[model samples]
Target: MRNKPGIKLTKEKRAEMISAIKSYYSAEREEEIGDLAAGLLLDFIIEELAPEFYNQGVQDSYNFMEKQLEDLLAIQKQ
Candidate 1:
């Protein structure tokens, strides 16, 4: 599997995520998944779902800057 540089998780964190995912499947779906399956699922989530989250973060930053600029303009108007 080609690793994604965009999503970097420490080894401990990676293991935690994989375990959590497996646990979620076991609890919610009543299905048992092994480490390999959990790892693949985590990879898929990072690759597919993370972009939407990243885009939202970018958009939020843009909006915050815009609000700050507006505040600065108001201060200048004073």
Candidate 2:
């Protein structure tokens, strides 16, 4: 199968996520990571992990909308 393109982030948003990743490592793991490392980690996550999350979100929305459609049909006039 063909691979999808990696998710793209705005420069500002990418910087923000890099900072958050650094902070998480510092606070939760007690390890400090530099911007380059953090940025690479973020890239890996966007490429490797984000699709599963995106797919789950799509599935959730589909299920919710399907239920709503069923409810709408139940209320249709005969």
Local accuracy by lDDT, each model: 0.92, 0.92
Q: CA shift at 65, candidate 1, in angstroms?
A: 1.6
Per-residue lDDT for 1-78 in model 1, tens only?
A: 556677788999999999999999999999999999999999998888888999999999999999999988887743
**In candidate 2, which residue pairs clash?**
none
lDDT of 2 by residue, 1-78 (tens): 235776779999999999999999999999999999999899889888899999999999999999999999999889
What is the alpha-carbon lDDT for the whole of candidate 1? 0.92
Candidate 2 lDDT (Cα, 0 to 1): 0.92
Give the per-residue Cα lDDT of candidate 2 at 12: 99
